[model samples]
Target: MSSFRVMRCQPLAREAGSVKKPLNHLLVSAFVYAGLGVASGLFYREFTKLNGFPEGAFTQLGLAHTHLLSLGFFPFLILLGLERAFTFSASRKRFGWFLGLYHAGVILTSAMLIVHGCLTVLGLESSAMISGIAGLGHMAITAAIIVLFLALRTAVRGVERPAAVAA
Candidate 1:
């Protein structure tokens, strides 16, 4: 009897969860990226001021701040706004792909930047291998952007056109 009750309630819980809210990975990830950007900015300033300012750390962190905000936070913010203005279709499989890919790009690119930045602060030179890795990260970012555009274009088509009004 207890097992039957558990099974019945479990489905109800899952059903409740499936009811979509206006928020999802895309919006949540945007806010997260925003927080990360702000955090990066704060760290950038702190590192720059430490020990009479480490020049390499200062420059790399500055680039990291802008990169995180612009490439990670800003794009997602725009996507969230678009989502609110035009609700995406409930079928979210592809949107999930877009979200996953975009985040992968963001994480990849940002992590490489941080690694490169740290190496610079440590007075290490970037070898060809390091440069290749950085380039790969940038490529992921570019590919993610392309995927997002494609996804948005397809989803936007479902939005009903405004009715024409006569003069």
Candidate 2:
């Protein structure tokens, strides 16, 4: 292996002009997703009851609750841990883009699910446009995943183990 420096990998917060902005953002996103997930669950129950929808019937609202909790809340929590560990936000531009795209995708996808669910409960047919928009949201999520992978790769590449000191 090549020679290593003791202080090679420094936390971004320790760097000049750096802050914990990414961590804070990630934490807030996790909480927001958690809230959304709970609210969607409640909405599913209440809306179906109000509409006299049959019990045990499948609805997009149920899926939305799971999606919000699994895809939105869990992912954000995981990203928070990753950010704390690797400081991937050091790649500021990429991180920002990833955050914006990811949040947009989650919100768009969940919103469509809620709308479609309501339509179904009300016995109304949904337009193809809703499905199309959800597809676009999924695409955005896919792109955000790629961006996150690249950012994590960059952060990992920047990290180096300290060399042992000679006796």
Candidate 2 is scored at a TM of: 0.89
Q: What does candidate 1's lDDT look like per residue over 24-77, in tens digits? A: 656677788889888887876675566355445344546777888888878877
User: Residues 112-158, candidate 2, lDDT per residue (tens digit)?
Assistant: 99999999999999999999999888998999999999999998887
Q: Give the lDDT of residue 5 in candidate 2.
A: 44
Q: Candidate 2 — what's its lDDT?
A: 0.87
The alpha-carbon deviation from the true structure for residue 131 of candidate 1, after best TM-score superposition, in angstroms, is 2.5
What C-alpha lDDT do the candidate models reach, one value each?
A: 0.64, 0.87
Clashing pairs in 2: none
